[model samples]
Target: MSDSVEQQLSLFRYLIQTRSFGDSTLRFLDSLLVSKDVKSLVEIRSSLNQLLKSESLSIIQSITAESVHNKLIVLDFFVCAFAIVGDLESCLALRYEALVVRELKSATIQLLHVSPLEWLNFVEDAVKNGFHAVAVKACENALRCIGNSDVQKLGRDVISDNLKANTISEITRLRNFSLASITSRSVQVQATEYLERKTREQQKLDLPYKEKRCLASTSFRNGIKRQNMRKLYKRQTLLRANSEMQGQHPNLS
Candidate 1:
């Protein structure tokens, strides 16, 4: 595996562990993929869209506060992928916004299974466990807002508990595993790099340089004269690639 590949994977895991993808932050991720993967952000957008079909307090709690089956957010999602995965400050703000939206959208008579007693214990445990700012508030609100119904109450409690448990687990598992120690993740990162390199395509756009940039910035154009880009896309693609993800990770025997 290449060292460069290992670094990128390590960075990704570090972010997830940090709760960079908190409830509110997930919204921005949805937006980012939609924005960055311009030609097709719909895949990610769809995943988030499915979550907000109107959250039932009880339904959510089942996954958390009680013993029950849980759905995988991403199948084969590397257990390590939960590292600090985003800009923490920004995610905090997004979580606040999500709260406002929920208040507006949720049904008036909401209930959760977690009791007020449990909420107190959960909050204390979460704080000690070092949840991200947004995650802390989310669990707090989910606990407070959901009231009176065994199912809804249970669901909300579970959600909060789940958040706490997940944070603790990830932190413990990776506590000593630094970028230097994440071998499995690094190997996968290198594999992805090799796959992309092998699948590289050489194609002609049949258009002019300025026109291509204009299309990219403004709208996709149809017909155009064959001319070299004002600059090549390799430079453009490379510009966004992080230094960690850039270039070939030296092959290590």
Candidate 2:
């Protein structure tokens, strides 16, 4: 293999070993390899899946902060991989898993400090990729995180009120954007359905009229045929009467 390919493989191995999973990891991978490379994406996903599968059930069930954080990291990587592979369902599932893990009270805010920017990035990416539901879910989660958190609990000694306010503002804006997209999409679908239904109803309404017109045409043709038959019968009867009169008047001739 080429040196560049080897280097990418090395980096992938390091990422798997270190459990370093996030947007930066995805960016680095994209820089090294094509983002849409199915082979590379599948390889990374398989490795991550194996690692998760190898974990003990007991560890997963413990629900400690460390375990939750690690799980979130894996889930984040899974989401990124599934997204690149165009597996929207799996991507959304992993995102939801990450959100749920982050929401655990045992997952201390100090340890699992997901910034508003991170949430915004996820939401924006989801929206850009036509994952409005995922974007909306992310927005809701971000808002909930903000509402349930305080600057003091953020594990930052130098945090400010302004920072929290700004975070809230950003998340609210994202929420509104996602909601509007969903609403617009819903309205478009409803309008299309309405038009289709009306078209079908109009066709049904015109069917009887079409049948009536056909019946009227047939009746007119039948009436013309009956009138012609009567005229022919009258002409034949007059000719027969004339023949009888000629025979009876021969003696006078």
Best of the candidates, lDDT: 2
Candidate 2 lDDT score relative to the true structure: 0.68
lDDT of all predictions:
0.40, 0.68
Once fitted onto the true fold, the runs of candidate 2 whose alpha carbons sit more than 4 angstroms away are: 1-70, 105-109, 152-159, 229-253
Candidate 1 lDDT at 24 equals 45
List per-candidate RMSD values in Å: 29.0, 8.4
Per-residue error (Å), model 1, residue 140: 2.9
Which digits, one per residue and each the tens of the lDDT, describe model 1 over residues 1-253? 2364345334534444443534544444333343454344454334323322222122333444432212223111211111223222333333344343435434542431224344444444434444434345545454444432233344434446555555444433333232223455679999999877666532233346666788786643332221234245666766666444544554421
Task: Please give the range of 10 consecutive residues that has the lowest summed lDDT in model 1.
Answer: 74-83
Summarize candidate 2's per-residue lDDT along 79-101 as a digit string, tens digits: 77556545676676667667667
* Model 1, CA-based lDDT: 0.40
